[model samples]
Target: MQGHTPTPVFSVRDKRNLLFIILGLVPAAALAFWLHILPVFQGLYLSLFRWSGLSPKRKFVGLANFRALANDSLVWKALGHDVYMVVFRLTAVIVLALLFAGILHFSSRRKQKIVQGLFFFPNVLSVAVVGIIFTFIYNPSIGALNAILTNLGLENLTQAWLGNPKTAFPAVLFPTVWGAVGYQMLLLFAGMSSIPKAYTEVALLEGATRIQEFFQVTLPLLRNVVKTCVSLVVINTLNRTFIFIRVMTKGGPNDATEVLGNYMFYQGFENFKFGYATSIAVINFTLALVLTFVVTRLLKKENLEYA
Candidate 1:
């Protein structure tokens, strides 16, 4: 007893397991702190100060930047545009993806794989690349779209799609919709695949058509997946507006297509209003957080169990 240690409560294996668990958590904790947590706090701090991102001194301007943002009609308009874009994106992504996913669900296994790959192809590319490709497609004079319109004798329909403020928002949004729908379809199909076919069979046996079966049985079973897709769509609509807007229109035809992300970029890098930009970033983050919270709560379930 004098020289030997007392009996340990945990065996060597338990202690070793605990050590491994702690070791596993250390890297993740460090990454979360460094990559996400610290940056958010730093952005908040910088938002209260005027720094061009180059100056040695950061002049503390208090809430002036945020106040300016609040008063700016353009900023408000940009916020409105963000909402509009999200609404459109959310609707289009869901309707199209869900429809196609349903179709793919019933397809033969071989055909399903081929068509699914085609649908998912767009999602694999970077948003900027898609934007660039679509930019060419929308070109009025020699673009493929205009050529098709001309060939079909619908020349009036083809204009400078990205140049006219009236057409710019929809034009830019088209590519985004094209790129986003596929991934959501994939998710929905995956969810559908997990569903037990017995439910569908039972519904069918009870005089349920394919449509009826989908509505009564499939949709209910896929609730969690649908909820998840909705959340992802909301999030994507918020944050993923950046690369598309930047590459395609650059928040142009006279700010008609301006969304929060590009507007923030225009403020920070182009205008050198880093403080103002940081304020925009803060507001963007806050709005995204609030919306994401609402979505999660709205989709929250008592239990996923279906027996």
Candidate 2:
């Protein structure tokens, strides 16, 4: 055994495989650090200071931004708007997507693809485009919505949807739900397709109605997929509603449509309160992370087993 190296716990081949795996992951890890992780840390660091982000002047005012945000009424109201959107979007999208997914799941293969495409078409357009299109539709002077109402002799129902605080947020929610439901529907449909037909057939054989089977069998089995969809919707509603709101309302009509993301943008770019905006961004990110974690844990389930 003289001059011999001890046998490694991992054989050469195993070590080679491990090396390859590490190499494969290195690029992705580096890219993530450069793109996502680095900016997050930068934002957090910037949040502790007062900076206009237009000059080299960065006054280190630790936690002042956070304190300011805590006392700011608009921040709280904006977050409340986000919560409202999360709740409304979660309810409307899930219900409608699930309903449509169920219908698509049971339809003929050819017809299902066509209908699914039609539903998903909206998702293909940029969010700004959808917002702009809806803006025209809601234009009181000559918008399609009011024009159609007038033609139908329902002129009393017409209002400047985006200009009225009472209707602005709800009108915004309509397009938000419409644009999102299709993708979630397709996700749920795929989940439904993965379930064994035997489970459904067995339920039917036992004289279970379709509704009973869905509730007792399909929905229970689709829990994991539904959980994913819920988390996605929550995160998107919290972090990505800015574009739609910006294009449509600009958080206007007395700030009734203000949400966290839009508020962050308004402060950072419009008001030159970059530090305050970064703090809001931090809060937005935290809220999304916490809510997603809470939702996932709430929906945690044991894996389904089949004999």
lDDT score, candidate 2: 0.90
Model 2 compared with the native: what TM-score? 0.89
Residue-level lDDT tens digits of model 2 in 168-280:
99998889898999999999999999999999999999999998999899998999899999999998998777789999999989999998899999999999989899999
Residue 183 alpha-carbon offset, candidate 1, angstroms: 1.3
- Which regions of candidate 2 deviate over 4 angstroms? 1-32, 301-303
Model 1 poorest ten-residue lDDT run: 4-13
lDDT of 1 by residue, 1-307 (tens): 3676545643335677678768898899999999989988988998999888887888999999899999998889888898788778878998899999999988999988998889889999988789989999999877898899999999888899999999999999998999888899999999998888887899999999999898878987888888789889888888887679999989999999988899889989999888899899888877777776876787676645565
Best by lDDT, which number? Answer: 2
lDDT of each: 0.87, 0.90
Worst 10 residues of 2 by lDDT: 4-13
On the 0 to 100 scale, the lDDT of residue 23 in model 2 is 90
